[model samples]
Target: MAFAGMLNDEDVRAAVKACQVPGSFDYKLFFTRVGLSARADVQGQRVFNILDRDQSGFIEEEELKLFLQNFSLGA
Candidate 1:
């Protein structure tokens, strides 16, 4: 897919395999590692505010890019 440039076949396969395994993913730890508090809701405003790098109360293109980069998703 489009992420071929950022991820190899093995990397993609590993992710897919990981998801296929039952209870293998710890979503709370994942979110916490990404600067989010798992104690609150996943789609909470706190998550939005953390992603708003400029604190402009609105997420812009650049801010979104940085946020995606944090997850190694290739801005």
Candidate 2:
């Protein structure tokens, strides 16, 4: 993954742990934690698509919750 170098495992861990709902994060928090907040809309959509899992056109709560596990099981 080209963006792998931009991710800090520790930061990802922290963000995952910070989810108040125990297993999910809203788009705002997810994007911010993953460093997508400043990207262009097109870039953000690409990231969202990667994480959306079900191809339902949105990152449902459960999908959002499993964001880390989906991409990096160890995270």
Candidate 3:
């Protein structure tokens, strides 16, 4: 399946806003809000890219701790 346009900025922002806690992310709520709860592997990769802020091909310790910030700067 095509992966392009799977998630738009508005959807992301809404998901983040709806699912974020004070200092952590609610994965189940966030994925459901983003419609990615049962998505494909490629789609999961897209999420990984978003979380991998440094583009280092991996989610480092700090990145994991600050993953919510990736979806929203003020998160």
Candidate number with greatest TM-score: 2
Per-residue lDDT of candidate 2, residues 1-75 (tens digit) = 434655566666667666646445565785588677877888767777777779999877677557677455643
* Cα lDDT, all candidates: 0.51, 0.66, 0.70
Clashing residue pairs for model 1: none
lDDT (tens digit, per residue) of candidate 3 on 1-75:
132477655666797777456655666777777777778988888878877879999988687658545558865
Clashes of each: 0, 0, 0
Models 1 onward score TM values of 0.41, 0.60, 0.54
On a 0 to 100 scale, what is the lDDT of residue 74 in model 1? 38
Scanning candidate 1 in windows of ten residues, the lowest lDDT window is 1-10
Over the stretch 1-75, how does candidate 1's per-residue lDDT look in tens digits?
A: 333333344543344344444555454543444334534554556656676768899978687556545444532
All-Cα superposition RMSD per candidate: 10.8, 3.5, 4.5
Worst 10 residues of 2 by lDDT: 1-10
Error of 3 at 34 (Å): 1.2
